[model samples]
Target: MLLHASFPFLKEASYLASIYPQIYLDFGLRIPKPNFHGLMSSVKEILDLAPINEVMINSSGITFAE
Candidate 1:
């Protein structure tokens, strides 16, 4: 399943994805809207818990001008 704005629930989401192969995470929408530092921190948090293959990068609603 594609999850949106999953930063705050990274731990839970990661655990779910790790045990259930059907679950997948997307770092979209909410991730890209934040500043670079915040984005990196969020991504790091998610990565720390979830496997790399289980997570996908999304640039939705993101603009270079931001």
Candidate 2:
């Protein structure tokens, strides 16, 4: 899927946090959350980085490679 939030719902949600915290209560928007861009960046980093096994081998020694 294309990396992004749930379209207009999240778009409108952006305003809900600032403009109307009360709207959150009205719409059950609890626990104000991070945005799609933040989440996407984190996911991208994980996908870009080598696996932990590879990292361990590189950082320590080949004997402990997974």
Candidate 3:
């Protein structure tokens, strides 16, 4: 869900060849693949942060409107 530049995948990702063989020798396509354990560990750390973890599990969203 972390689509921003701060996503760990971006940091570790390197340019890779395209899935299909390149027709032209100019360049190749690249895609980002995450280090799954690294990403999950970060998420686990955030979830362990306290009552935020508990509230997050039971609630859909919070609203201030009355």
The lDDT of each candidate is 0.73, 0.32, 0.28
Per-model TM-score on C-alpha atoms: 0.73, 0.26, 0.26
State residue 20's C-alpha deviation in candidate 2, in Å: 47
Which regions of candidate 2 deviate over 4 angstroms?
A: 1-33, 51-66
Q: Is candidate 2 or candidate 3 better by TM-score?
A: 3
**Candidate 3, position 7, lDDT:** 35
Q: What's the best-to-worst order under TM-score? A: 1, 3, 2
Encode model 2's per-residue lDDT on 1-66: one tens digit a residue: 111222324444334333443332121112133887765553333334323222111111325558
Model 3: which ten-residue window has the lowest total lDDT? Answer: 22-31
lDDT tens digits, residues 30-63, model 3? 1123577754554444334322212122121244
- lDDT by residue for model 1 over 1-66, one digit each (tens)? 657536578778877877888888887756443588877777777788778888987667566675
Candidate with maximal lDDT:
1
The true-versus-predicted C-alpha distance at residue 13 of model 1, in Å, is 0.7
Q: Which candidate model has the greater lDDT, 1 or 2?
A: 1
Backbone clash pairs for candidate 1 read: none
